[model samples]
Target: MLSELQKETAKAIVNIFETGSARGDYARVTLLTGDSGHLTYGRAQTTLGSGNLHLLIKAYCATPGAAYARTLKPYLPQLADIDLRLDTDWSFRNVLKEAGGDPVMRDVQDDFFDRVYWTPALASAKRTGLGEALSAAVVYDSVVHGSWIAMRDRTTAKAGAASSAGERRWIGVYLDTRRDWLASHSNALLRKTVYRMDAFKALAASGNWSLDLPMMVRGVRIDPDALCLRPPVNASAIEVATRNLRLTDPKMSGNDVRALEEALSKEGYAINRDGIFDEGLETALKSFQRDFGLVDDGIAGPATRLMLGI
Candidate 1:
């Protein structure tokens, strides 16, 4: 059984990657060809590849006992042999999103994640004698970013042996090694995402090895005791009138501009609703994107719109 702290920590960190605190399964496409010659997609991040969705579909069909499993059974075979090589095909992507993003299916997916990923981490943590909360947080984050074995390998290489060092020292070594991996990776995306390591480093630096105290991950303060399942106010309803908005389009003035201002203001960015997409708005938008782990391109394109849940 997963502890409350473990579950909450996992949810909080995943929220940073999935929707940037915008709760609800917002499906986004991330295409990659795996070593097994299969294309991976959706929110598996880099670890499970496209196999994540494939596994989810399989698990759902196998467990007809689940109240919601039967509803998704008929659609199983069609998705059973998904070839993500053609991930761009609307039929494929739509079906994938519907199944993967269904709110009812989340509990099923969570169970899958816990079984496949979190449980193993707990076992490893127990062997290392790590505190429950800290171990879960470290291992859960690693599963999303890559794999626990890789993390363990690095920890072993850096800190000599887990038996030789204290829990705090071992965690510090693991985090430092993770930072190095993220920084020197061949993939540009991996290298650029070192901020995750920085967040872990912050926890270590504060000596919060137990992770029971208040913590901050990626500029967002997390109060574990007062943690609410709901996201920040209006996170799901983040939308702006972009019918005629663009960079440096002299006519940045419109209802769209006013709408954007209101949205940004709700996010705590003070802006005059003067119907102009001025430098101020652009700066605030970039800041928001940074906080949410979105690309800081300062352009409100489809990706940005999706991140804002528009």
Candidate 2:
């Protein structure tokens, strides 16, 4: 089994490829034209066209203390149906973007991606007798990016099974085959993603089978610090504005809630900036809503969040 750090390094490599960040962009949303995976979102960019986006969002909505659950719950039907119209729905897209900043949403995504992609990738690696961390990373990428089975079969047919041809050699052949397939794919968008394979080829060439840290991927640095889960160093105003804060059974808690409390305190409300949205924060929020002529529901939806400037 790969050590925890090696697994993290492997994941960070793909995270950089997927979202341009080693830690992954929890709030990143991409909709590339001619892309088979429509309306990609969160860490690994689960695709709406593949119905995984629905699964990711559904998982988030079910989690308690999810800041945007109420706002996002309404769109579950459209997501489940794989409604392509959602590709252009700016409102839904904005909500998804904002939800990315929520800690609950981030946790849900880590778990969901691991369950849906990482676990299977590891199993595939073990079955092929491929124990190298880099090998696992390549398989994980194919699983997340799609068509692993077809490409794995093609590579086996061309170069023989990894068990017989040897793991490293088989992986090299697999990468070459996958690179060719991506370059010649009918989907123009997919053709552009051959860079992923190119990056892997470079890594294999360097003999970095262990996925050592301090690696550079697509111009992003994947260092020890970059792999740690933390808030973005410089968050955009829109990301901050999109967080839907509210009280929950366990009490929503995060920097977003702390920002809301600080804003309320600035406006002459007595509240603590402890990052926990408890009853005290809710009561203060209700008072602020009443004073601002908004609904006094205490749920910090867009209106309340906007009013508080959080």
Candidate 3:
């Protein structure tokens, strides 16, 4: 099972790619504020309600004992104590008289924006240019928080008994050979089950789990709408997991084959989509997974699906 963080990371990357399509500019904002510092949306002259630099704090919290824990530290030096007071004007008038323009804020804005616009959605997608780090920051929140889930069916819905007095009939000795369904599982298995508990509850009780957005502005339309994390189906931008050569069968036709070929090529697997996975095709698919440091299983599973970027 993948971590919520991992899924969020993927979702964020996807969103940035999608935003670039609609807005022509998907910015990466690196708040030059402290952990508990307040983040507000204020125009050059207007003011907005304060929002705790909650996203940043959540990022740090997600990674418990990371060496480079605070994501904003590299950008906001001389980090002040976490003060979540909203509506306090950034005294630029006094700031200008005391010291020149804010070097930190300027630096953060320049770097963050540059990164978001420059970084390719895929890991190491750059070819012949400077790379961006903050682009990774835009999707930062989506890939971290827990998503709601629930059980699709109820357990122990039926009980069996003989007049409430269960009796065992004489039977031959029965030897068990099956192993426990969850015995000796990896630690990740347990963590994933625990992580999705909230979603499980929501599904068990209701049917949907919603993400708690960091408050949205009233009566105003925010680009990349604050509500939806996933991209719209009609989004112009498409995700390509990787860039490499791909192959297709001579028998395959038109756009269907074309789309599959492109998707697979992005995953570094080139195969002719001649409506069949022949011997050569199977070998190629397995080799592609191997090259990606994936489980080289012949079957194409979730990881491979992700690689296909669908």
Candidate 4:
């Protein structure tokens, strides 16, 4: 069994990958193009497309003292149906974002993601004879990212079982194999996500098999302070709320627009990442909005950004 700090550190690594915060952003809602799991939300960004999002919200609504229980109860059916329209519903999205700030919602997400992701990941790690905390983390990331089984099998096939090849070597092979797969994937969005594997590879290379504290992940420090709810060094709260990307007469262009274009392309939209919010980008955004049942206003406001996972 892993120690508490090890577990939290492992989780913190993925939390940074998910929400850019070591403590996680419970209110984070993400929708990416071409992602099978659409409308991902909460601390771990559970996806609606996988029906796990329905399970998560149901658990929340059933819990006592849930701030949005009554308000969210009415939308259970749509959630159960994996309704893509919920992606664009401003009021519903607002409620979810607001509810995320509730203590009860945070507790529910902690419990839910633990039960749904962590527990299974641990089991998979134990089954593979991998006991190192970093190994557990690599497995956990695969589980959260989806297709743990496929990757596990692929790794075993290529490099032998973890028990046979040794845990460290097996994990190294897995990371390299997974990185190659992500880099060569037909989906452009998945290709951009090789950073996940790269981060894991960095941890492995550092001999952090024990997952000691004071580690740097994707430039964010994960130390005692960060795990205790303090912000990481050199990291500020992601201003996802105030960001607004839209088409203008002169065509707005910047890193934000470039990020949006990347996210849009990941969603399978045909758009170039020219860092310009031109009419073409707006048209693509509208198409994405229409596909997800959001308003086709061609605006990448809070609601739209939440959907785009940008």
Q: Which structure among the candidates has the greatest lDDT?
A: 2
- Models 1 onward score TM values of 0.59, 0.72, 0.23, 0.72
Task: State each candidate's clash count.
Answer: 1, 0, 15, 3
State each model's CA lDDT, in order.
0.54, 0.78, 0.28, 0.77
| Regions of candidate 4 where Cα sits further than 4 Å from its true position | 227-310
- Model 2, 1-310: lDDT tens digits are 8998888888887787777788888998887766666678888887777666876887899999999999999998887667889999999999999999899998999888876678767876787778999999998888777777678889999999888999999999999999898888777667777888888999999999888877877777687566433322111111011334667677789877888888999999998778899999999999988887655767665335534543
User: By lDDT, highest first, what's the ranking?
Assistant: 2, 4, 1, 3
Weakest lDDT window of 10 consecutive positions for candidate 4: 232-241
Q: What is candidate 1's lDDT per residue for 41-114, written digit by digit as tens?
A: 33332212223454555566665455445555664443433444444556655655665666545666666555
- If both were scored by lDDT, which would come out higher, candidate 2 or candidate 3? 2
lDDT of 3 by residue, 1-310 (tens): 2234433433333333333221212122212222111232110100111111222222233444533334334422211222333224344222222221333333332332222221222232221110222212212211111110001001111212211222110000000000111122232232222212222222223321222222211211223453443322111111111111223334324553355455666666667666454555557767866776554544343234434443
Clashes of 4: 3
* C-alpha RMSD between model 3 and the true structure: 21.0
Instruction: Please identify which of the two predictions, 1 or 2, would achieve the higher TM-score against the true structure.
Output: 2
